[model samples]
Target: MAWAWLVSRAAALGSGASGLAGRVWKIGADDPRRAVHGLKVGLALALVSVFYYTRPLYDGVGGAAMWAVMTVVVVFEYTVGGCVYKGFNRATATVSAGAVALGVHWIASKSGDRFEPVIRSGSLFLLAAAATFSRFIPTVKARFDYGVTIFILTYSLVAVSGYRVDALLAMAQQRISTVAIGISICLAVCVLICPVWAGQELHRLTARNMDKLAGAVEACVEGYFAEEE
Candidate 1:
């Protein structure tokens, strides 16, 4: 009886696995574009991986090569517009935050040891608070919420780490460089291979809706004329 029960359980598991495979196949079959998007993403990742796989490139970035990978994963979107939007936000935020951090670090350093911690802490609190508050504004929230969030995060890390990390400038430069490399690869792939433009999609949708509305209006007018006749 126990042997029979075990066999039945194995059969059930096998059927479930087959069902899952079938569903996955159906999704790809229903929309070939999904498969194309997947391929594009894979290509972008492969291109970015060259930074780590090639000796010269790897040596240039050193351990920071992983930032390129992370940036690609985080910023890549299905549509070109989305990818560009996110990439621009990330790059701008990183640079701005890094600059501010460096400036603050310089100032704090010049203020002597006793006041350095106090200055750093005060700057952190004030900047973080202001960035957070900006999110509440409709215009800023709509267009730059992501950038602001990244700014807060990047600034906090640099400011906090500056306490112990003497080579803050080098560290920030490596990260920014890797991120830029990743963004460039992603944008290139998105634009060159199976390009999907969000603006085009929006245009198509708008035209379709306009056509439907026109047809509805024509039908209403025809009905009213026929009734008057």
Candidate 2:
């Protein structure tokens, strides 16, 4: 009975894998552009991974190289506009947050051990609350929502961790630099390699739709005149 149960589970898993493969193939077949996009992403990742694989590059950023990898993963988008938009927002947010955190860390450091924790905690709460609230504002939400979110995350991480970390400035700088590197790589890959422009795609789709609508109207008008005649 156990053997039979194991075999049944294996068969189910195999069927699931087959179905997944079929769906993947269908998606690629439906739009070859999607496959190209996937290749672009893989190429970008490989380019960024050099910071990890090369000794000189690894030494420069150290463990912070991982941030570059994460940046590539998060910032790379299907469209060039989207990728640039996200990359800019992330880099700006990280720098802004890191600077503010450094300032707060400095202030807290001078306040004596007893008050240091209090100051950091209070600042974290206030900044986080403010950032979260800003997300509700229409304009900010539309353009800068992702930036605000990154601000909150980066600020919280640096401010809270600064308490125990001696080289807070160095760490923040390394991370910011690595993030910039990643953004640069993503932009380069997205723009230079079989680039996908969102604006062009939208324009083409709109033109096609307009043509269809015009054809339909022309047919309707001809049918009406024929009926009258």
Candidate 3:
């Protein structure tokens, strides 16, 4: 149950990350190119979390192989999308770090029988930081923070699995079929319903923000002209 809560919270964070990335594109944020960067960063972070928890879904494969496959997917999808959205040459530091973390996951998984707490914790921190920072950070340098968040998250999962493999396995089984179906339905409904619901809320908030911004700008303009006169 606790793991389920953590997973749900992480998914929410990922969804918000996606929405924020979209907002960055819509608004032409600083270096409009960063919007594409943000999207890739968000996708990479989300994929890492997905890959870490879904290990049992695949059979008999070593952790390294599984990690490699997921890393490739994240890279290919992000690169393809980034090329289309921003341009072929428009890669960000975040994407590079994402690749590095994926490689690390593979290595850590293959290294030993017992999970490495340090590496796992580091990965979780990187992932969480990446997802949070990609959309919110205006500074380009902060993009690598996702690496730390994901490192920590992956490590935590390993710790749980190491201690209670049966429990973790059971959770995985329940989540795979049931959670997937439930979430698929919920997402479909959200797509159908949220636009109308969220649209109204967003419109109201946007209007309010515009009003405040307009008043502030007007006051600034008037003050400047008054000084000139």
Candidate 4:
């Protein structure tokens, strides 16, 4: 069963890499190393969450905290950064997110939970600072927009949802650990297999790009010679 799970995950990773490689080439004029960095960032974030949440965080507090933090992160990414509400007053999204946070805080307060606003407040501050810095820092923008967004928005949502339900509803630590381990193994396998497929796709795209470059160079040369003539 373990071996099967490992193999399955590895296959998924390889498939994902193959899909990713094609998409990367299609996006036009992006740095290959940067794209790979984004991929690694996503994978690292996944591993971090698994390691952090799976062990538990002050019982229900940990889970609640995770949700609270997640809510903020999602709201910012989908709305502010994505500019989903661009024409419609950007503050609308920020205000809405604030309201949601307040409501959740109120609920937690009513439950007699100790107010631990620090985690969320600090997170928001950092998120804002990071967003602000992104304008000035190209790599930060690249890392967050490409690396973090890809994993958190795409991969982690489904993965975390399952982890949360299993951890809470069934209280199954062993089961969750097994799953995490399986995923890790699968990721490793994918790394090995993906390079072959991804390399071929990269080569094809690079050849195409080179062809365009050649045509542009020829055009420039012809124009220069014609001017001389």
Best by lDDT: 2
Question: Per-prediction TM-score, please?
Answer: 0.83, 0.85, 0.27, 0.26
**Candidate 4 RMSD to the real structure:** 16.3
Residue-pair clash count for candidate 3: 25
lDDT of each: 0.93, 0.95, 0.46, 0.43
Which regions of candidate 3 fall more than 4 Å away from where they truly are? 1-106, 113-115, 129-132, 138-177, 188-229
Ten residues in sequence with the least summed lDDT for candidate 3: 81-90
lDDT of 4 by residue, 31-82 (tens): 4544553554355345445544655532433433343223323322211223
Segments in model 1 whose C-alpha atoms lie over 4 Å from true places: 203-229
Prediction RMSDs, each to the true structure:
4.8, 4.0, 16.6, 16.3
lDDT minimum window of 10 residues, candidate 4: 78-87
With a 3 Å backbone cut-off (N, CA, C), the pairs that clash in candidate 1 are none
Whose TM-score is higher: candidate 1's or candidate 4's? Answer: 1
Question: For candidate 1, lDDT tens digit of each residue in 1-229?
Answer: 9999999999999999999999999999986778898998888899999999999999998778998998889888989999999999999999999999999999999999999999999999999999999999999999999999989999998999999999989989988999899999999998988888888878978999999999999999999999999
6, model 3: CA deviation in Å?
Answer: 47
